[model samples]
Target: MTITFVHLESVHHKLSKASHKADPFSDARESGLDIRYATISDAFPLDHDRDLHREKYWTTLLQIFPSYVDEFVRKLIRSDPQSLHFLVADTVYVWPTAIARKYNLINVSFFTSPAHVFSLLYHLDLLKERGHFLRKDDAVDIDYVPGVGSMRIRDLMASLSKRSDITGNTLFKAFEEVKKADFILHNTVEELESDTLSALNKYQPNYAVGPINLSEASSVAVSRSLHAEVDITKWLGSKPAGSVLYVSFGSVVQTSKEVIGEIAHGLRLSEVNFIWVARAHLTSSGDSNVLPDGFVEEVGDRGLIVPWCDQISVLSNPAVGVFFDALWVEFGGREHVVRRSDDLFPSDLRSADGQEVGGW
Candidate 1:
């Protein structure tokens, strides 16, 4: 059966470029799955200033795009009643399952964040009831989480507040929708989060079919093509194992000059070889030169700071010992949380039979 993947145009543009370079559809085609991308931009003009317009433009976009989404669904339903629809992630799949149910579309939801993070958000009401809503300091110890070690309240708080701001008060709506999906796919590995995955399996059919990072398997040609001028993978190949610290905070998160300076200081204190991708205009303050004076000279050849670089290529490199970024606490909190190598690749890397394997 064919599958139609519907996503926001802004996201699709990036993914289509990546997918074309990666040729992900070729694998699907080889497996007899006809895949196509349907984007909102195909149906309506996008407001580049959607955030500025706020609810007015948001409602306008929804009204305009639902028909486009519905039409795509209708075409898929007509082409093959059994055609499946995959939504990339919670943020992109803003429509209701009722719409899919009306069209008889087999809707599956994908979550790019860790499952434990979702579970925490799913129980946000409970956390709030227990006096965990907003805090002045950005850090707090989060206990009672399933499958994984404790998370700082600051990290949890940031996610919760940010979700509320972006999606309004219904924080659990996405997780609730995910549970009702035909199936759920997580961009994580079972071994990396076996405990959390086990807990999630009790509620729904969930698959931890990731690190979902294609960069690890990407060819040098694809990497160079995607990144344009900078060939990070080739440069990383020359570095020693566990020498470089890869730094990135996805595409959306922003950091201030003070926080950026702190991070630079922290990295210098850590004394690790690093590649820092400092995107321009990260803050309106325009104090992008947040690094400590003589910091680069101190590290010498041990550090490289570029304005932008391909993240996946950097993360997969053997030289990358840690991935560091400043954590923002939107609500209130003083403590910052960092994800260590162990967190990404959990310690219990062996299977039940004691065979050496890679994963959770």
Candidate 2:
């Protein structure tokens, strides 16, 4: 079967001219996989700083993205109508179901997060019925969501805990569209989230087959990273086991200067040797002054702060103490939570083979 990976390039994945010139699927070609790759324009300039104007950026995207999807689908089907059988897309897009219907394609929605999170968003009506949608009371218990245990609304995802913001509303609407999808695929492990996945399958065909990033590619290396990656393997090898902390807020989520300062200060106080991926555009202001004043000099050689690094490589290193990013599950580590800072190191961490490691 031929698989075409159509990447919709947005601010999160603004392509550099060099990257645009490079063949992104050379590995797939070398591996003899019948895969095709294409990059679709998100109608934003390559140099546009979306973070500097986030609200306007997202609002405009919502207005224009659907038309682009429609045109793309129309042209592709006209080119070879019978060749296309399935429309697989990220669940965040609000137009997949409609476009699939227009083309008579079987729509499959892919939710990158765990099934538990997907279940919460999929049951948006249930939240509204239980007074949890747009809920401001963070302390209230959210016990009614199917397959999810009782947790405070405070523990709920920020998108649901806070008042419906532009992005939150987009996600809510996207999930609503996702319900109409012919199939739902989750990036979660069934063994780990059996109950949650089982619950979701009752409404639609839900499949658990992810944390796919950890999977080894067949025969060739194909990199899809949007940022330049620095190698920290040598530096990490020098640190003692269970002595370093891996700090990152992920690629797209931007925080305020205040939050960056707080984390920086906490790292200094804790005296934990660390590697922090302070990616470009990490702050809403898009300024380079993300770390606190004199932070580098104060921490000196104890910390390695770079614009980006190979995260899975860093996490796999034996010297790293704990994984602090809430975005990805811990692969190896004794769980440790710093309650004062409300940081959690996930417990019962396992490697790809399901073997437990002593530390991250």
Off by over 4 Å in 1: 12-33, 42-67, 82-92, 135-142, 148-152, 155-157, 162-164, 167-172, 214-229, 284-300, 325-360
How well is each residue in 56-166 modelled by candidate 2, as lDDT tens digits? 777776888788878987887898876857999989888898889988999999988888888878888888887776655646888888888887655566666434567
Pick the lDDT winner.
2
Model 1 clash tally, residue pairs: 10
Please, what is the TM-score per model?
0.71, 0.88
Mind giving the per-residue lDDT tens digits that candidate 1 earns over 280-299?
Answer: 55543545566778888887
Q: lDDT per model, in order?
A: 0.57, 0.74
Backbone clashes, each candidate: 10, 0
Task: Please tell me which predicted candidate would have the highest TM-score against the true structure.
Answer: 2
